[model samples]
Target chain A: MLSKPNVEVSNKSMLGRLFRKNNKNIIGIFTVVLALLFISPYIYIVLTSIKPSSDAISSSPTFFPRQLSLENYVTMFNQMPIIRYFLNSFTTASISTILAVFLGALAAYGLSRFSSKTGHAFLLLTLCVRMIPMISIAIPMYIIINVMGLIDTRIALIITYTAINVPFSIWLMIGFFNNIPKEFDEAARIDGCNVFSAFIKVILPVSLPGLATAAIFCFMLAWNDFLFALLLTSTNAKTATVGISEFLTAYNLDLGPMTAAAVSFSLPIMVFSILVQRYIVSGMTLGAVKE
Target chain B: MTKESRVSIYFFAPAGIFMLIFLFFPVALLIRDSFFEIDMIGQGRGAFVGLSHYVDAIRSERFIGATTNTIIYVVVAVGFELILGLFFALLLNTAFKGHGIVRTIMLAPLMIAPLVSGLIWRFMLNNQFGIVNKLLYDFNITSSRHAIQWLSDERFSLFSTIIADIWLTTPFMMLVLLAGLQGISPTLYESSQIDGANKIQTFLYVTLPSLFPVMIVAVLIRTVDAARTFDIVWVLTQGGPSNSSEVLSTYMYKTLTRYGQVGESSAMAVMFILLLLAISSYFLFVMFKANKK
Candidate 1:
């Protein structure tokens, strides 16, 4: 009986030791492998963008180019209205994001502070609108924009993106607003400030991070939008996303300019994402934890 | 009304009106249009067709194929995304250096416009002189002579789309799951470890249960989004190679805009909306119930 117990204890210890050793190796190796997989495609795109046209089209693509050049980037700027598209995208997305964030903040504050049952209903309704597929709204929006003579206008894009983003932005902002203690509002109210003034002066400053989160997401959504941009805009107000698609149609099978345009079109969004990485992640996972 | 009530109304009115006009009104108009046949060429001079359009839409083989393809695409793409996303999330959740940079880089694909992603993938997946084919050939995994038709072939086009979709969206899943993972208290893992629980046991008992709620939310969101994927697939294949890769959204676009079959297209649109509503509501119901629990 003594020998049997001793043997069992030794066996368990051996297994535990082996498991720990293997687990460390496995986790470390897996993390590195995953990191590589995730980064490779992006690296490939950047490398290819800088590669000469001849090398890009070569049968065996070079992982590391012998001669790197900004020829493609230069060609992209010269061959297409790249600057014009960037301006259009920037203006539309920025204006829409500003409007959406403002509207969303106001609505969220209202809902959180007053009218409990009705506010819940209204919030639910907003979420429902957000759930509706963009394609479902595509045709009617097309007709409505045409009828209103707003097609191909930046105003049209701004209004449309705002309408779509408000629901989500409000939803996210409500969570943030709810987290702000009621005492802060009461203190502001007691300080001879009305609700609106309190909101502007006190609440807004405190919730800047949340607001930034909402604004960044709203901007990215509007910036990266393709479908509405395609439908609403023509040459005059065409956003970068739509402009890139137009490039595909214009260039057809010409890989050089197409790839260059693709690289140029994706650059701003990449930079924007990296810039707002913290806000975006926080905004995205805002409601994942109730506390 | 109370002072608070009045203030609430004033604050909410603008956004409410905006949503009503642009979102609710358009949706109402879409529902109405589906009931009528409006000819684009003839300046909206078409008769009310009632349920005829819906009937035609349901009967059309193209619509049926689109429905199947969409279901398949959503199931496959979302399945892979969830599994792969969970795996990556678990990997990233560990205490590792440079994890933040990796997370941001993983999100790089998600940041790009879907159209741009499609274009990039199109270049990479091109049968002739494409990077993917060249890589395979160089590694002797496949011959240059046997270069796979990534986009043109029906069997492969959908898979290629899935690859692009996974690349763009798995990060979203990872982000959500990472949030979920963070919510799991380290105490639970510590207790499990003290009790002599193995890694898989700890994951099964502790990690999964804690992650379930977030997983449901993540999966539902991804499913709804995937079902409505239009821009990526539209740019990549345009429902090409005999309409083998066409989903409902692309099919509707082609039917209405390309072919000018407004009635049929509207019918398809209505059906698509109904299907989307059903799926979303189902997900919402599940989420609501889970939250209640």
Candidate 2:
């Protein structure tokens, strides 16, 4: 009886030891599988983009293409003014990002230095404005832009995106500015720098990371926007998002160029986003989670 | 005013005026237009129609159906995200090899544009040439490649969009929850273990309660975002197959742009804003009460 009880105890301990030893390996496998699952769809898109037109739409499509060619990409460029769409997306996103960050950073500095009822109330108002659905103001914005005769122009896209991005920029920069000591600007002030000049010199230099984060977010917003682009721009100012979507209807179920266009349109943003993933994760929740 | 106060006003003026002209002014126009019959082509405002547009929206089956679909989308999409997000967060909380790479890979979806995501999904969900059904058939889960029609069928169109959204946003949820999990104190878990709590018990009592505040914030942000979703649904099905997948944003777009019913769309937009405000205010109230404790 004594030996039997001792044997059972040893068996249990052996099983526990084995579990503890293999647990890490099991977890490693799981993490790899999950990562592959996350990325496989993207890889598939890339592969499909490279496949010849006939292979892409084949009834029995395989994961690995039988033939690899850039024919679809060539077709995509020929079919539409693809380069123009890219340029429109790029210029609008870049210009709006710069403008929004500049205006927003200034407001953030003002609010941080002098916290009054009006400033605080303005902060709240911006927050509420951020919550307003984009569709709510679409018609009015369309009419107003039409009245200004800026329709079908990249300038219209730039103006609208800048306005849409400013509130978010202000909100994000305010958090960063609040962390900055009042003494930085005060020291600059003692050296005969005025409020605006002090901000230009002392504050803006230290807030580069904050500005970069806000810019990246604004750029993403403008780049990813489909609704406003669809409404505001017609031909000359059509963005990549709208242009790629047009392939859905314009080509009548043409998978080859469609996939190729989708890949080219999305790849740069994906690479850019991944490289700056750290800044993005923090900006996503608006600094709700402190690092 | 003091000199510093005066300086601050100069700082505020540029952004303030810009927002007034572009943001606030447009919203004010939206409200005003909702009350009048507006002509886009002729650039004319017809006679005031009181609350008739609002009444028309309330009575319209399309508007009501869109509202129902929006609510359904928000609930199911966010619901699955929370569960899957927590699962991934817990799985990654432990130290392992390639942890950083795996986490980065998980974030790739968040980086992809929603319009692109929608397009990719539409391609994959195609019955004849799609890899998704192909894989399922290879694995013997389905009898044929055309066993399920993803975008073409009315029953699965909305669900198809939901899947794409789930794929795109789940990483965000995971990142937020992972951060929350990291913030939790180790001592709480140690104490729970010492008190004879199993893994399940410890997760339920120590982990969940501690993660509640972060969860609420993440959920609220996602709720508002998912409610405004336009790109994915628009790209995937355009709310088609007899309008089975029509959500508020798409419906309003069609009403205004497709049908050119400016007054009706504006009224619907106003109603949509009010509903979102109510939902967010309730969430804020709850968060406020939670914080007071």
Candidate 3:
């Protein structure tokens, strides 16, 4: 026997109270605050990049730039072969990613489809390599690469990175390929497709998300690499990481150009992560825990 | 049977050979090199000074410092990253608006290369013109009017390295834990709630038990990574302020590449690898046991 006006008012108040009590609201605020903290250094870098060196070095730092300047960016380009370094990083990372992914997928397909002790062994080897620290390989790799006369070359970087990433790519792809119902592959085979053809036609299309994740990981590994890039490549084939290292010299450090260089170097990985975040997270953590 | 076997071998041969050559072969060479007394300048000119390099490395004060620092680095960094990562994961797991974007942004540091992260932090931790100091001063948090010498001081350099490491790696831990959290069924929480359980009790009984396996794996990975940390420390401190920040890898690199003592470095590298292997194997065993249970 409630009046319509009274019923409507009560409903409105209940909804309002629900909103006030919702835990999501509290969580949302907390997450935003933490996210801002996570990105604070990068934000500071961007702000510092535009400010004059004197302002940057001042005891009391300004939060915002009073005057914006492109001097750091300009100086970074002029002082070093920034473009050449970028090209080196790009070409090496791209080629390595392509090679690693293709070969990894091929190997993963074979491993997942075939049931054999050897396949298991291959999988074990992949995991072993993934776990071993890179220093274990650095000196011998140096010796071997030197012997091959491939010092200070993009090919050397590409080959090393590709070799290093293939194991991970294969391991990741195996899980993805495994998750797909084997019935699809079986049905394709029954329809007169060979294993290779079925993998190409059916499996590849279905595992695009997995492939993308692996490709991004491979690219990031090659791109962000420093130790191999530092030891193997001199100025002739130095990547962005090596280029950033050159910002610090024996006599003096250029803070402005260094910040600008660091920002530019990190931009690609940042964009890629933002673009393909969903796959990267799921793919990286796919086989980490068993159901 | 023969034909199928042959095809399988053909499929695996490329990957297998690559690992044996590039991965196993290098480790073998490291072992071989560790036994020799090779100077840094020469390519391979050395005598077979069996165990001499190992003896020297064990006795070296720098090696001892590196070992101590490496242990401290791994324990502190991994411990803190795990705790912080778990906290953030729990925060993000709540049904929140814009949670997805926040999660992605939190993962930004993980995606960036360690060297680049080191450089980024180096800029931020700079005594002059660094924003950390700026913020501290702006908020009147620290009365020390000068920019903190983060890398220059040995006492604070390890902590500085830890900060950068924790920043770079906590996302990895969070991602793993988040995935683990997702695997958990909501029905359990609902049942607990029906029993008049509070948030903390439900989380302790349900969430913590389910997350144990993934947490172990995540911690293991982070521990191994933290123990072998080189690039960030290398870029930031380079084991400076009188070798106070030197971890094992940096110590090895300095001996071989910088100080021209290849044999000693190789021995140090071998020891470092063995230590890591032992730790990782133990973790793997724990994981297997957990899975069996």
Residue-wise C-alpha lDDT for candidate 3, range B1-293, written one tens digit per residue: 67655655566667767767766787888889889877645576689999998888889898899899999999999999889989999989885888888987888777888997788777777776466776777789877745477878778898899889988888999989988898898898889999999988988999998898899888887888788788999888898889989988787777766777766777888888788878878988998897899
- Write model 1 residue lDDT over A1-291, tens digit each, in one string: 355668788999999988976776677577877767776776677788788877766766777776887777777777778789889999999999999999989998988887457556756766566567787788788878888999899998998889889998888778778889989999999999998999999999999998998888898888888888887888899888776775555234456666777877777778878887888778767555444
Please compute DockQ, using alpha carbons, for every candidate against the native two-chain complex.
0.55, 0.67, 0.61
- What is candidate 2's lDDT per residue for B42-116, written digit by digit as tens? 888998999999998999898899899999999999999999999888888886777788888888788788899
Question: Which digits, one per residue and each the tens of the lDDT, describe model 3 over residues A146-214?
Answer: 878899999999989988998888888877777888899889989999877888899999999889999
**True-vs-predicted CA distance for residue B9, candidate 2, Å:** 1.0
Ranking by lDDT: 2, 3, 1
Error of 3 at B54 (Å): 1.9
Worst 10 residues of 1 chain B by lDDT: B94-103
Error of 3 at B239 (Å): 0.9
Overall lDDT per candidate, in order of appearance = 0.81, 0.87, 0.82
**Pairs with steric clashes in candidate 1:** none
Tell me each candidate's i-RMS in Å: 1.9, 1.2, 1.8
TM-score of each: 0.92, 0.95, 0.92
Q: Name the fnat for model 1.
A: 0.65
- Model 3 chain B — which ten-residue stretch has the worst lDDT? B3-12
| Reference interface contacts recovered per candidate | 0.65, 0.70, 0.62
Give the Cα error of residue B172 in candidate 3, in Å.
1.8
Local error of candidate 1 at residue B263 (angstroms) = 3.6
